[model samples]
Target: MNTTQLDYTDITEIRGPLMVVRGVDGVGWDEFCRIDTGDGQLRHGLVLEVDGDLAVIQVLEGTTDVVAEKVAIRFDGAPLRIPVGDGWLGRVCNGRGEPLDGGPPVYGREMSSVAGWPLNPVLREPPSQPVLTGVSVIDGLTTLVRGQKLPIFSVAGLPHLELATQIAAQATAGGEPFSVVFAGMGLTHADAAFVRDALDDRSAAGELALLINTAGDPVIERILTPRLALTIAEHLAFTQGRHVLVVAADMTSYCEAVREVSAARGEVPARHAYPGYLYSDLAGLYERCGRIRGRPGSVTILPLLTMPAGDITHPVPDLTGYITEGQIVLSPQVHARGVYPPVDPLSSLSRLMRRGAGPGRTRDDHLDVAAQLLGALARARQARELAELIGAGALGPVDQAYLHFEDRFGRDFVSQRPTEAHTLDQTLERAWQTLSSLPRRELTMIPDRLLDAYYRSDHG
Candidate 1:
């Protein structure tokens, strides 16, 4: 807990959207502070940078028309804090978690700061639980393990929006007690409406809660949105004891917001013009999700980041990959070739995959079948490359078969949209259908029971 709070003293300058202040101690970076005009008006600012006795604050409300000498800042002795409670469900809130739907304020709830997350005790049970979104690729290959932090990395022009909506609409865990805390960072009005309408029409909006900050909103608001969303998730998982899935979309914009605040504070820049704290900044958010010991419910996070120009090497994605458990990457190049969801299997992976997939959980043959299918697909792709080099006219029958495998795998598997989300069983069934296209001798990797159960004709 923060001890010894400080009182406001003097403001040096009110630069556009920032302020310089003096006479404060223990005001750490990103700590929220309140400024009073000394005339019954109050505004909020975050400690942007600290230089000995001086601290730079970015006024979230903007520093306009407020004379320097009249300004007084009350150091909260901590970063911006929000109340987490079960009452927040089914309600809409601002970036700060204050109710925007004409609901009551978040008072009487245990106050927690936005930085550093609570980790579940290691001796606690491991997360073998699965939260199905009905999306084939996610459910079958990259299963979403409860308490894991999975990020979706995408480039512009992919169907990430559509996939996000489909997940919002259909995300479930065997119809068990569950809830959703969805936050949209820097979403356009259309995308915002798309999310709202998806939840509303499905009547899941009531079970679903939202914290939306549009692209036009202040950059600082983006920083606040996801925390508010996860606070709600934690409230449900730890307090109300309900399974919760928290989704934060377009974290690329969130990173931009971090840069904006960093720039306002005049901090040094990092790769691709991001702040130096980008890695720890993301870890602070991703670290929040988990299944606490003895808790009946768990909180899972699915944070989305858009890689600029499809470059995963971009600092935002690079740093994110380092912190997150795994990534679900979307490919625009594949989408252009007509693959819905457009996930690049080779590029994406789920680090917590084994915990959520297996017999009696997903299916007995899931791991082996998925691996073999992936291997076959890789071989087929190689064969297609060879055909391209040696001319298809001279290709052997086996190579010709591999070409067919490559073509159908792209069309039948990758081309399926999220709207047509398949259950794990359906996905595996489809996998077997495709596998039947290969010779029986090549099916050596599959169990005899599965080989008989699913290997069929008419794979395409």
Candidate 2:
């Protein structure tokens, strides 16, 4: 095969899907290639957007004049790959792992496929370890189990993107046995940039590998991007025993891609006009996160998907709620009211909370503090609604105190410093401070010792 003809045969358009060009003899799919255009300009491209035996090339510079007649693909004779050496600890890369932050190419090392395979069960370990994200609402309550697939359910226009960044920036497992693989799907360029910048600010550029499928990229690529990302993660986690966190954002878009492809193949529809196999498809991804039995490494997942019209019953979220551990639900109302994470505590839950929280994992008081605060706020919310009919002036002292408790919970404990990353201790201390506003007798859920120690700081 000629290395110089931009050589490929059977260049056919899938109409709206994308173009697939079959390499003449030994061209690689998703490998680096170039096309000589109308006026002798070399256009850099990647082999993809393909069918069986046909490799698709997307010209990052856009295809205008380059056609079958003059296009020549240089098959690097390998799959599109990136360097995963330790140098990745302090560097940035594009969705494809190309260094994007103006660093030199990750040089002179072996290359491997970004789309990796699952680990063998014999070498895997259970994800019984806790990975704290420094958010009280998360770490203290819904502790992130290392190697667990815990998804965040959100609606559009919520701060889910920003929230994901915070999780990426602050997440830490025991003994520092953790890394991150961030897979963004159907995100806008700006959204992608924000996450990148956030990671940069945290000095976490290298520890986290980003697989981005921007909104403008072909839909098929979005589907491929996460699978590729997880594949790479599985390699690092099980093979290397490095606990890896895989964060896939906008899984709704991922599902939509599934729907589109299914429709393209003319399949029957399920609830919410999604494909019928949505549940199993999601499980195929989510179920991959876990300790395999005895391997030192693990891969935890935080897959984000938006619910249409904020509907939890929507098939995407509904199926997700069932297959995975509990969820961190983002509420638009709370977000618009100026909460940073905008996590609706009442609605969110962590089913594996018991295993992940305790003295060693976190403070022993973490669980009780969470419970007391949640219960008090729930009561306060109830009291405030009652005051609407009975009048705040007529309500008893406990009821009024409940009202005050509700306000402080929303304003102080639930609200967060936009720039500051709060540790689990700080979050709990702040919760205690807010809870201190209540009378001692009302602290039913909390143990008496904590109540005496923490409840009295507010000497009224």
Q: In model 2, which regions exceed 4 Å deviation?
A: 1-13, 18-91, 102-126, 203-205, 457-460
The whole-model C-alpha lDDT of candidate 1 against the native structure comes to 0.78
lDDT of each: 0.78, 0.73
Tens-digit per-residue lDDT, 149-206, candidate 1: 8889988877787787788678887777788888889999898887777667443346
Judge candidate 2 against the unseen true structure and give its global Cα lDDT, from 0 to 1: 0.73
In model 1, what is the error at residue 304, expressed in angstroms?
Answer: 1.0
lDDT of 2 by residue, 253-272 (tens): 99998787666544588786
Q: Model 2, residue 16: displacement in angstroms?
A: 2.6
- Residue 53, model 1: lDDT of 79
TM-score of 1: 0.90
Span of ten consecutive residues with least summed lDDT in model 2? 1-10
Counting clashing residue pairs in each candidate, in order, gives 0, 19
